[model samples]
Target chain A: MLQIKNLKATIDGKEILKGINLEVKAGEVHAIMGPNGSGKSTLASVLSGKPGYEVTGGEVIFEGKNLLDFSPEDRAREGIFLAFQYPVEIPGVSTTNFMKTSLNEIRKYRGLEPISSVEFLKLMKAKAKLVELDMAMTSRAVNVGFSGGEKKRNEIFQLAMMEPKLSVLDETDSGLDIDALRIVSEGVNKVRNSKNAFVVITHYQRLLNYIVPDYVHVLSDGQIVTSGGKELAYKLEEMGYDWVTNND
Target chain B: MAELKDKIIEKYTSTENLNNGEPVEIKHIRDKAKEYFRTFGFPNRKMEDWKFFDSKPIITNDFKLVTEKQEIEKSVLNNFLIQDLKANLIVLINGEYSKENSQIITERKNLFIGSLKEGMKTKPYILGKYFAKYADYNADGFTALNTAFAPDGAFIYIPKGNLLKDPVIILNILDSRKSKVLGQPRNIIIAEANSDVHIIEEYYSIGENDVFSNVVTEIHTDENANVQYYKIQNEEANAFHVGTTQVFQERNSIFTSITLSWGGSVTRNNLNSYMNSEGIECNFKGLYFLTGKQHVDNHTLADHANPNCNSNELYKGILADESNGVFNGKIMVRQDAQKTNAYQMNKNILLSDTASINSKPQLEIFADDVKCSHGATTGQIDKEQLFYLKARGIGEKEGKKLLIFAFANEIIEDIEVPELKEYLVNRLNEKLEKL
Candidate 1:
């Protein structure tokens, strides 16, 4: 459902993603493992159409359409969601209000009627329970005083609310503890379906134990240099990337 | 130095005369005002308050005199109407009261609303002593100039031992048609002992011509009386507005004033509150939201002249684009004003890199048993918050707009009036939609 070829990107005159190629089909979970400064986060940023990123050479196709031509909002409307590594603390903006506006904006772009208040509340309550988010947190300012784990859970809560076809989790398991990691992984697993996909990008193989991926790819520098089955994650955890990249 | 002073005095004399035809009253206070204006005719960059926003533009621009009366159309005046405010509406076009446009409903025996000229001619002794008594004319040059030309102003009075349930709204509409206009719309609100009332003064202009609105509102709160005053200045972007509201509270009285300035190229609001009696309380709150190349300056002073007086001041502003905003708040406690509780806070947000804010909160206390504190904060939107919203399938435009709206909602939440609050929020969202 998604294709990337020669995806080269730079930010502030510094080359990030030199050249990359990846493909993900429907109903499949792809885990992109890379070291620090390996352009994994840069790839997620470019896919989400963030500003200040210079896409020098790249062809990104989503659902058979060129995805690079759309604005950030338009990209979101077309079912592309990014679970931020660092959730923002927007003071005075209620969580429900922010999520409602985003959902309605995407729905409007898709030529759908705005969701009724009753339906929106029902959806919020159901998805909030999936991530174990407090109702009080939903009414407060978006992540203003939330803990690290609460913020990560809030991100997953929003992901379940939007229900995008392609979800990019950019280091969602980095700062999470064992309990939080389990809860976040379970939340992601509950939302997975045949019609949707997820790209879990992380530096460690521990998160894969909770939410097993169908395919494991080793991303060195920029491109994915190695691809294997789900067992590849455990093998890499035992033998680091240096062991694999030295022979490549 | 003498040449600059003479030039300042000559600027007013060389201008076309508007008072030559009419024979108005020359009271002692007005005579003092004339002398003050002649001595310090026009303010220059030398003055601290007039340094940032000089009044020389109003002096250089050829403004139409009060004698040049033009017939304003009803359609044109509709733009100046705040149709949502449920109060007695009085519309003043170019400093002149328009009875045809004013609506007085259910007037009580204690309330009276009419022109200042009529009040001066009919109630001479009452107007003579009380008029210009509250304002510190010699302290500011524009205040002196406004007092010098006190014609075409409003006079509102509430008698003793009566509580007025309804509010009185005065709409000051400056018709800046064709030429740039200069209008000095003065107002005097007097509340006797045991009286209660609410007054709102709104400033609006017609067309986009360069205009200057210099207004001064003097309020007196007697014993056991209460007055709620709201000054709203939403003039056009090309307009220059300077307003001074002086309030004096007697024993066991209360005065609450809120100044909201969202328009005008350069707007300055100076509010001075004097608690002259024991157990008197005053609250001064202001919110200014500026965009484009607009500039808004708010300077306030709360003087505790007696013991057991309390004053609280909270002023906030949100600056966008290349605009500049300022807030200078001063709180004073005299030696006799023991057990005085005063607090002042001014916060601002710069929405753009080019936007700027200058804030100064001062406290001068001579009383030992007083509780006073002042705080100021200026900042931009949190970057992590912006990224968080964008990641939730929200676009950049909607994200920025939401952040700005959230930033200003802190001040809007203080507005008690439900309809006015909703109207302001909707209007603000409309402005944010364009960005």
Candidate 2:
């Protein structure tokens, strides 16, 4: 469902993602583990079409369409979601309103009728229980004055709401506790199906335990060094990426 | 004043003659104002109050004083109606009073509202006593010029202990039938002790014509009286607006003034609040949203002359396109005004690189025991917040709108009037749609 060919990106004229090529089919969870300065987040940002990032070379194809030709909204409409490492705090905009606008915008782009308010509220209520989000939190401004765990949980809640085809989780487990990690992973697992996929990017193997990816890849200097099965995660966690990369 | 007299009598001649209203003219006061204007003529660039906003354009142009001789159509006044509210509408077409579209409810007691022509005979004593009492006639040149042509104005007086449940809305329409026209719409409002009233002055234009408006309003709040004054200026993009609002609060009185400026080519608004006695309080709030090539300059002053007085001023501006904004706020606490609590804050957001804002908050305090603080900030939209919204599938346009609205919600929540609050929010939403 996704293909990357020699993706080379830079920020402020400095090369970040040197060369990357990957392909993932449906119903697959791909875990990417890297050390500091491995260009993990850079890969996610370039894939999401963020401004100020120049793609010097290569192209990304998603669902048989050139992804780089689409605007950020168009990319989102085509079911491409990026969970930011650091969530933003938007004041004076309620989470419910934000979610509704986003959902309707995507629906309109797809030429589909907007979900009724009653149905939307019902969906929000049922999804909130997945991550154990409080109803009061949904009524307040989007992520304003929320704790670190709540922001990540809120991101997952949105992931569930949008139901994107390919979800890119970037450092979603950094600031979460054990219980929050469990809840967030559970929410992601609930949305996983035979036709959807997840690209889990992290610096640790802790989150991989709950989600249990089908493939594990190590990224170093903007390039994946090796690929293996689920047991490679435990091996990397035990010996660290430095040992593996040095041995290689 | 000599310069003004020479310019007005020689360069710009009045084409229309004055109306024969009761033949009761205050030549003595007029002469005194002229003499004062001679000493305090139009301010140059050196003056502190008129530093950023120069008055050279108004002085150099030959703007003839208008009268009610021109034909005015009813279609011009149709768009200025606040159709939803229970209001007493008073429309001024081309700086002249329009009685056909105005009506005053007589159910209220000890209340007097009429044009300057009617007030000349009905409430002469009240008008004579407090006509230009608190206005700094020598400081502003156009204010003196407005006083020289005081026939085209409004007079409002509410007696002690009277409450006006309905708002009295005054619409000043600057319709330029001839060449570039200039209007001087002056208003005098006096509320006695324990009286409560709300006044809203709206400035607008009908057609696509260039006009200049020079306005002044003198307000007096008696002891323990409360007044809510709101000024809404939505002139045409081809117009220039320069106005001054002077307010005097007595002991234990409360006065709140809010100005919303959305349109005009070049606009300068000056507001001053003087707390003359102890236990008095004042709140001055302003919001200006500018787009295109518009320039908005706001200068305000809060003078605390007595002890135990409090003053708060907050102004916010959102600039888009190539718009420029300037805000200068001055607060003074005299030696006797101890225990004064004064706060001032100015915040701005420049959406485009060409958009700019210059803000300066000044405070002069002679008293030692006072709490005063000031701050100013100018920046673009927060990218982190934008990313957060986008992560949730909200598009860029909707995300930016949410941030801008959130930036303005702090000030809108401060409005005490429910109807006005809703109206402001709706107007804000409409303007955001264009952005």
Candidate 3:
């Protein structure tokens, strides 16, 4: 579903992602575990076409098209979703209105008619339950005064609503408690299908236990040093990242 | 200054029977106001209150006082009316009341809706009691000028214990097609004890020729009265307007005002409210969106004179394409006005690098037991908020538009009238689309 060839990215004249390459197929979950400042979040940002990141030398192909040619909004319209590590608090913009606008824009890009108000309400209700989001939260301003767990759950709620082709969970489990982690991981597991793919980026092995990955890759010092099956995650959890970095 | 002063004196003295059938008291007041204007001529940047606003163009331009009423087609007049509002419409053309175009709800007793000149003839006692009482001619040059040339405008009076079934829509239309014209519209609204009323005052210019409007409105609220007032200014791009609104609140009275300015070459608004008695509440809100070399200045004041009075003030400005805006708000708590609560905030967003704003929120509290705070903020469109919206598949234009709308919506949501709120929302959207 996605391919990266020697992905080299820099920000402010400092190299972050140094010749990183990875591949993912349909219906598979891939876990990219790395220490702090190891370019895990940079990979997610570059793939999502975030501003202020200069791609020095690399190419990213998604679904048989070069993704670098599209703008951030166009990339979003092409079904690339990046759940932000910290969702912005937008006062005076209700969550329901934001979701409706986003959904209609995406639908327009796909050559589909706008959803009716009744159907939109029903969809919101159904998807909100999958993430256990309270209906009252949707009526308030977007993420204003929301707790950490609620913000993460709202991201999952958006994921369920968009139903994108490729989803990048960028540290989605950083601030979640045990209960919230279970609920968020369960929500992600429910949304997985044969036509979709996910790149779960985290710092710990706790989330992989809930949403098991088919492959695990160790990212250290701006490159992927080791790639193996799920057992690699257990080994890293048992012996920490030094085991792989020293071997490399 | 001398040339303009001589022209104004000639214009005032040349008119015949200017105060026909008026009492000697009103004539004396008019004479005093004229003397005040002659002494001040026009305010300059040297004055403290007039430092930010320059009246050079208004003073230098040769403006003919519009004495004769001009003819306007009914179709043109209908365009200025609020189409969906079921309110009493009072239309003034070239500073004169147009009887043929006005509609008054006459079934309600003790509700007066007509021209100020006619009101002077019929209800001279009430007009004389509160005509130029609230607005201080000595403090402001524009107020003094408007009072000196006070010819004709809307006169609204609601009697004691009466509730107005519909709002009063006062539309001032200027037809400056033949020559550069000057218009002074004086409005007086008095709500008696235990009464409720809503008034919406708007301005429109039909022709491209320069039109300078000097308007003053004085409202008096008796004990336990409630009044909601709105001022909408969307004149032509070449039009210059200076409007002053002074409201006086008695014991336990409630007064709220919202001033919205969208278009004009130079627009200056002075809104002041005096809380004379205890347990009064005064709220002032304003929003101005300017583009294309437009300049708007808003100066507001809330005077808490008695004990246990509260006032809240919020003003927002959005400037784009080299537009300039200024906001100066002051809250004063006198020595005897203990337990006073006053809050003031002014916020601005500049869309372009060339656009600028000067905001100053001042608070003077003499009473030691009062709680008063004021703040002002000026910034550009938040980039993180913009990126958040754009990353959700919304285009850059739509993203910026949404953020701007959201910023302005905080004030729009405070409007109590549904129709007016919806109208403002549509107008704001239209303005955002152009930006």
For TM-score, the strongest prediction is: 3
Q: Predictions ranked by TM-score, top down?
A: 3, 2, 1
Which parts of model 3 are misplaced by more than 4 Å? B1-3
Ranked by lDDT, the better of candidates 2 and 3 is: 3
True contacts kept of each: 0.62, 0.58, 0.60
Candidate 3 lDDT tens digits, B1-435: 446567888878777457687766777788888889878877889988888897888888888875577767899987777767888888888778889888887446767888898899889999988989999888867888888777888899999998886898898888888888788889999999999988999999978688889999999999999999999998989799999999999999999999999988999999999999999999999999999999999999999999999999999999999999999999989999999999999999999999999898989988999988899999988878777777788778888888889999988898877888898899899999898
Q: Write down the TM-score of every candidate.
A: 0.84, 0.91, 0.97
**DockQ score for candidate 2:** 0.52
Roughly what TM-score does model 2 have, to 2 decimal places?
0.91
CA displacement after TM-score superposition, residue B40 of candidate 2 (Å): 5.1
lDDT of 2 by residue, B321-406 (tens): 99989999999999999999999999999999999988999999999999999889999988877766665566788888878887
Clashing pairs in 2: B1-B38
lDDT string, candidate 1, B302-389, tens digits: 9999999889888888888999988888999999999999999998878889999889899999999999999999987766667666
Model 2 error, position A241 (Å): 2.9
What local lDDT score does residue B42 receive in model 3, on the 0 to 100 scale? 78
